[model samples]
Target: MAEALNAPTETANAHAESFLRDACATLDRLRAMRPAFQRPSAGKRIRTAFDLADECLGISVEKEALLLRQALADRQNLAAATSAALLRLAGLEMGYRRTRGYPAVAQSGDWLQNEQFVARNSDLKKWAESALYMSAAPANWTGRIAQALFGLAAGAAMAFAVAAAILANRWFPAESIPWAILIVISYILKDRIKEWLRGGFLRILPKMISDRMRDLIDPKTGRWVGRTREWVEFPAPSAVPAWASPLAAGEFNALRREIPPDDVARYQKDIRIQAARLRRAHSRMNSITEILRLSLDAWRERMDDPCERLRFVEEGRVCEEIANRVYPIGLALRFSEKRQGGRHLIRRGTLFVTRDRIARIVIEPTPEGGIAGGGAAR
Candidate 1:
């Protein structure tokens, strides 16, 4: 009887050891995952992941056995990397969707254009707005900062140069002054002139960017989708800018005018409106006919592979770019940002594919551009 009892005790001990061994193996496998724990102190480092075991669920899991698993994960596996990348992307979208406001979250369709409005442009538009722009939103400054600096510097420099010449009495008899202290007067005039010209251009730049971006992305049809040839107000046509050639003077109208849907009364529906529009009427006249004006932009990108990515921002240049880009091949996405007050809002605009890939998108302005509750129109 004693011998039999001892045998059972030994067997029980062996079973316990086997259980412990399996647990250790499982723990080691989890450690190989290289899971990155989310915490306030670690900044925003993204890490790969796997379907955490049930033990890893719940907020406090980080301090639990689940935490133990994450702590042990290996950081360099394909599966783990993919998970981390996805999480990071998802986090970005959440942040953007929040800042872009309710527009991106709108229901499928409503008084405003559908949430997937880009779906309407063309195959190229599709590749652009949806894929390219989305992937490149954080690449650069919006060009607003540099433009602001240049304008301010140009204005200030003119004012100072005038003041310096008058004070030093260098060149051009200072005594010829009608009032002797005319330097101050000229400085004021110079300052005002510089401001007036530069300010107008700056303000118009955003509007231009918005309009051209919309057309390239939307390319619908409307009254305003026609292209205009560059105009030169020549005095007897002696010194016309090269851009003012007769060939450049053609309206070169786009085939379509894309406009946004009017959704102010859309609360009855559960949709958010975008700030833009497109015209669908000009699809056949010419590919450049798109209201979103994407085709033109693509053409321009191809034409000017300029440094720092800041050339040909004007609609005309963008249109030309689109006209030229796709004729060749390969896709190059561009990204930028604009600052307002103390905060910065990054925007990703692109010359991409539309549904059938006709070439561009053009949207119409709804007076208010479908902005709700005092929101600015696109």
Candidate 2:
């Protein structure tokens, strides 16, 4: 019975391996035929190859699920190994497609397979990456509640002020000067009360709420793998952290030789992952990758022209030169992983940007604070 259950998984594994070998050879053939990709037969051929690759993964994943229902002792371990193997095969196919210039050069090559290949690549990426699903939302519930409370307090204060004025109107009679004085005092106090509460609440709001919350889910096992909370603040130059300032100023002030400007923003992200839960949910998964993309559309809009002309005397002759203009943006990063006994890593980098897009990024050498983990600091 055990062998009977194992036979399907073994066959699927062998088929997947065989397909990987053939897929590599097919890709090589396709790359060599780049010049002829304009032909309809070439597109059809490319489409057929990827179709088979997708079918191979689909069948393998379904077969691997069977081992979970079996009473065998090593079934979970076997399933994990099989899943890892399939994921590796898919990843390799995707990587080779890029390095060999399959789709990247297709636009200029005018390959008929361009659209199909893009769609196929996106599908393969999701399958090979993992079963993790993520969603993020603004974490402003506390802010809303605080706003409601402030409104109520303001309304109550104004109500009391109006009530007192009404009572004083009867006591001193509206026609008298004393009644007029009491009304003036009540109006002034009402405005002051509203402003005072608003100022206090604004100061306390940051400590009370995060900007956003993100949750990670394992779709396969219906379990949560991790969570993250992020905060963003525009701190004054004087308020920038002591450690971050020196690094930014060291590189930023080199060009102008002046004090660092006051326009500084601080962003922080706290991530908590359940290592044990992730392992249980996805035995093949080793680590999670987080991508942070900062949009510079506003900065780009405010930039000067991408290039400027300069006139200089060269060899005693007047000559004009047009040079590309670029600006430097400094970034100081500090990361802490409590799991590694509170290990810390610091990295500094500068991004050179043209008016249109980022040109390049240059990073300084790592400092004495060793990296928390074995992977490269991204």
Model 2 poorest ten-residue lDDT run: 64-73
Instruction: Give the candidate number with the greatest TM-score.
Output: 2
CA lDDT of every candidate:
0.35, 0.65
Model 2: CA > 4 A from native:
1-133, 137-140, 155-180, 221-226, 246-262, 309-322, 338-341, 370-378
Q: Write candidate 2's Cα lDDT for 254-301 as tens digits.
A: 865475574777888888887898788678876677778898898999
lDDT of 1 by residue, 1-378 (tens): 122223343443343334334544664565455444444444443321222231221111212222222322332212344334334433443343446342332234473655343332233234334422211122123355547656775867586757766664764565675445566666677777677767766666653432212112223321232221111111333342222212212233222113432111100101121223222432342222112222445445445323222246575555223332222221211111222222222222223343234354333222221222322211
TM-score of each: 0.21, 0.61
